[model samples]
Target chain A: MAHIHLGEGSFPLWALVLWTLLGVGLISAVVYRVRKGGIKTHQIALAGIAAAASFAIFQLNIPVWGGIHMNLTGLVGILAGPLLGALIALVVNIFSAALGHGAVGLLGANTLVNASEAIVAYYAFKTLIGMDWDVFPASASAATLGLSAGAFLMGAIIVVSGVNGSALPRGDLTIAVAGLVGLNLFAAFLAAGYWGFTVTGGAMPWAKRSAKALQRGVQEGGGALVELGRGIVVAGPIRKGGLMVEFGALVLVLGVLGIGLYVYVDRYGGFEDGERPAR
Target chain B: MTVTTLSNHVPDPRLVTAFAEQRDGPLHRVNPWTKIGIVGALVLAVTVFDRLALLAGLYGAVLVVYGLAGLPYRRLAGWYTLPLLFIVSVAGPLTFLEPGTPIGGTLPTPLGELSVTWAGIVLFAELSCRSLTVVTFALTASMTTKYTDVAYMLGRLLPRPIDQIALLTYRFTFVMLETLEDLVKAALSRGANFSEFWSNKRLYARILGMTMLSAIEQSERLVKSMEARGYNGDITLYGDVSRPPIHELFVVIGSYVAVVGYAAVAVYGVRQ
Candidate 1:
């Protein structure tokens, strides 16, 4: 089979072209929106949210205690506007590509997959918000719809691109699906919580407090390990700082976790391709 | 494609001008769209299949383009040589995995499951050629087209929403960079050199945290100002210009012809 390897998966040329065009179209629209003041501040905030979501999706995963792991760019998009979210996913995908997560050619498709979540989220939120419900209730309801819709969109895109059915074997599909679900839920919850907190208090209390504590903890010079840990903690919640740190952390975690999954899947998961499974 | 070894400090302006030359005498008068079409067609023709032929065409075409563009010097010498690096990075390991004829003695690798092959080398060369061709065409397009013209062309090609975004992004790129710089400077004044803060995670966090806070505030102000002016989902273009030039037709035709001819010849050669 001719597989074009990218950030983490293989895709066909059609997917690449389709996704690139979509990204171009979406990003262009967002730019127009920014210029025209169709919620410009929201767009930048959405961009930040998307970046954060990309980081959360890629970096922070707890071992499911099984062979499966998680990733979550879609959930982030749900909170951010589709266009803005897609743009953020593109930025993250590009950054990831630089680090060899996928092939450079696959940047477009990867961005498209991640952005689908944000787009779905935007519509979902719009629909829920029009209900005129209270902010918290609306946010929660919207988040659920956004997350599920985002996952469904991802699944649909994957299936259409032949990624789920043919690109990956039946066994790997389960792992990927499971990972996607976990990532979506986690991202949606975090995004909702952040959105809720931001609207109510102008800041996330937990993240803010965590940032303060982390700063205090790292006031004195420490060992390399301590410093690294401290960097992660302090960097994890300072808005933009957290986003970059979180992204880097996610890439490292995913890489290590991906390798682990490959080994476990090879031994127990039983890859159908017969060739060495992609990490 | 010709890697001009830069011994001198300054780039040779004449070579760059020569390299940037478009479709010769008559084509010079052609429309930008036609020029774009020709370049696009040529690039597409070479890229579809067979990296070797693509590379060869790219090398030849780029050399001619470069000569015409008057660019004989490479700005970033290392970047231009990246094709070779990519080939080695991919092909070096692939050779061992393929299990082909061991032309000579064994070479050591970090991985125990692989060995080298002549096939791998050929594959590497082919891949290198593809990359080189892409770089050449990209460079040619960039050299020949102005940023504004490219933006204008892209705007015309895309939907109204997207086209407007391209123009906005292009216009705002410098503004964003300037904003980023000022923010960075402010951070620096407050004992925040991000490079030094690497040893201190808290400091790193503080810098980014503070920067984002300020960025958000500034963006909010900017957004408010724009909204106050009754900005909506549309941006006004500087002038009403959308007509294609008469000479552009020839340029577009020539481009398609060259691309189609190259692709046809290469495909035929490959099949035979």
Candidate 2:
């Protein structure tokens, strides 16, 4: 879900070397451990199949978030364990890059992003299961956390590497990346919350009812606004229609406030075109 | 779902394998190692040089090589969509934010003035060239190199169990893809609505979860079959990769030397 789609030379040479070295170091450690421990034949089979599954799914575009793809690295971690899971991340990224889905030069950075997802998911799931959580909740929570960690790491990499031609300063880039990560975390949690809700068969009926009421109220308010626009105001107490008017006013005020804030920043914020501001 | 929508822009692994096996092109005959070495050199060249002219030249040469390999230019163009999108998303803002000789007069907005800069456009072009060069060559290599050769290379290049896993993964990826396609078909047949993601998130999750479960079951069967065939932990790849011919080796070495020389000159300016 969180993949760096940057091109070759997107990062400076030093960043490229640093990320590649770190990626290689991690893979080396994993390989050394695998060789020493001597993996069972079944485990080997699982890893291969898991890699195949991950690679296949990586290419798929689910009709979510305007056709986004899911990594399922968390599931790979849970099933294949961390060691093989990390290896699977590398294999998947390599195959993906070869097919032009990701940049070959950024393979090292991408592998780290994905491998961390798998490793974190594996440990999180284990800990949750150890704490006597159910499979559905444990897996869901772990996967969410894993994806959030990957998103955060991806943002960190981008900010640290810094886009070669971007005009934004490091501080500004960090803020932008932080906002992106926060949005990703929100989406992850939303999906997990929905999953939990459905799996538990409407565990929070009151919350569901509240959502339905809000939706209904919004719809009714929209209808009332159209009526008012047509000069056919109903002679009744304020209801859903009034709620709609209030919501519209709130949105208008917020929009104005946002514009005001932007103007303030433009005038007061010490930034110049492609140049860092005086601290 | 239509096949186009099901697969999107992803290159069919089966088609890639078929091309490698069936195409009797000059590229197919060339050693995979030589192609890989040249790709490495191209990557380095793109990384070290930021000049638009040099990057453009490299891109043109790569396209020529791709064409000479008898690969389909139409498909190559189609594959450019993702890389181009990436470049645009990253470089688009720079056109306004970068300080330079604006191509057009700046437009005054409430917040600030926005202008497209020559430097920004050059940066965008440079990135596109760098990205597409590697992407085109990679596709060419994968399409030309046989699966067995790729497996052998993986075996030789990667460590013990990882190599074995990669080999098996490569072989089974097609199988898993077919399985997924079937699953999608079944779901669509049952009146599944995939267009509205928020409304059908559960359905999407179920389909993916089913694919995972299918993979686990398939792996169990695979393990049993391997055990029956007297399989040990190691899965050896059949056939050995031939070395690049001597002349090709020289070209590869020369490319490396040229890249190194260029990098040295770029980093430490040449003295008179």
Candidate 3:
């Protein structure tokens, strides 16, 4: 039972240190690339803003699939690219650690896991963006595959840490390995699905288009506010009423679904051990 | 539960005093690598052994070393209690030793028939002590050694190529942090207020895109400065100062004695 339960509980300090060095090196090299790109100062300023906002995005821990929730640091990596994005994620995770989300010791492994996802997402998007395939299919497929890559790497790190010739039994090590695979992959898939749906807004070229349209709608709404401030005769109350009506309907639908979920979970699936009730 | 001295706004005076005393302390006179080597051996001795009483003895020996090093008990206790409460509340509940499925006590149902036998309590206590022992020693090392010294030691132990990268990463960490702070302040001043940015997706996108561009640009500038100064994939660092022979010998001999003492206590306790 201890073999299954504890399953290779020790970590090699040297291995952890070495991995941290490698992870930090990868981030530093990325920083070097960003410096060499010779972008305009304002653009550089913009990038900093983007990175900080992305850091906030990583902290926004929304519930997703599979009964597991984690910060979307990996997605930020994809959007920011390997170098700058990874650096930001490293900073964010460090702050998160100080808040007790995870240990300072696991920083290297966590950074690598999230950074790989980001790198993979960037390349995947670039590869499939203008390809002659259906945009949704390509985006969804890329996202799904990228998520699996993150999960596999996280699992592999755990397995590697458990290896100690002659000291730990093979069976015990395997149990630990399996446990990591189950936990990480389960969380990864749910996160990938949520990101693909809400953030991507339907996937591929279409996802990009939807996001752009939403952005335009928001821009138009801002323009309306400005127009009202100028006291000029603009789009009448009817158009404003119509927009509000549409928004109200959408909110109403989501509110109903959320309440439904609350009721269902309350009736069945008694909250798991160690889980705090929704406040 | 509130024992977080390291991050506390009002730092402990004893910690400050102990740290100040360490400026002219014995450990400072010892070679960094020697301290590291002894730390490594002690880490292995603690981790590879799972015996509870053994871990407690290890903890005892560590307390004595800290006492000798002039580390205040209040400071140590402050740092140690949080992880201790965490282990008891979480790991303790999970470590239910199945001693013949001991009679289900009259504990409430939501607590889930917690059939904790004597063995379970003992195991949890041991594991918690073991973790605290290693953690305290780590804190001691961190409290004493400067980060640069650790990086320098790594530079000595590792090949020149690998060590160079380590040095660069360590040096630039603070610089990047400052850049991040400045960027965040700039954003707040430039109308990307938190509530508006979050509620409006377009504003959020603009904010995100802008931040990314700036971070990339900042990174590029940093790299260029490094390159201009003849930084070509390798980092060069300064030399290490000589340590007194007596201090080095104490670290070496004291570490051995501590490990042996821990083992003896463990063996005796287990036999009983």
Per-model TM against the reference:
0.50, 0.81, 0.51
- A13-108 in candidate 1: lDDT tens per residue? 335455555545545444443333333433443344335323322321122221111233333443344544555566555433332233345455
TM-score of 2: 0.81
How far does residue B236 in candidate 1 sit from its true spot (Å)?
Answer: 0.6
lDDT scores of the candidates, listed in order: 0.43, 0.71, 0.45
Taking chain A by itself, what TM-score does each prediction score? 0.47, 0.69, 0.58
DockQ of each: 0.02, 0.25, 0.04
Q: Quick one: ranking by TM-score, best first?
A: 2, 3, 1
Best by lDDT: 2
Query: By the TM-score metric, which is better: model 1 or model 3?
Result: 3
Per-residue lDDT over A92-156 for candidate 3, one digit per residue giving the tens place of the 0 to 100 score: 44433333233355566667766666556544644565465444444444555566677677656
lDDT of 3 at B16: 40
Question: True contacts preserved, each candidate?
Answer: 0.01, 0.59, 0.03
For candidate 1 chain A, the 10 contiguous residues with the lowest summed lDDT are A218-227
Between candidates 1 and 2, the one scoring higher on TM-score is 2
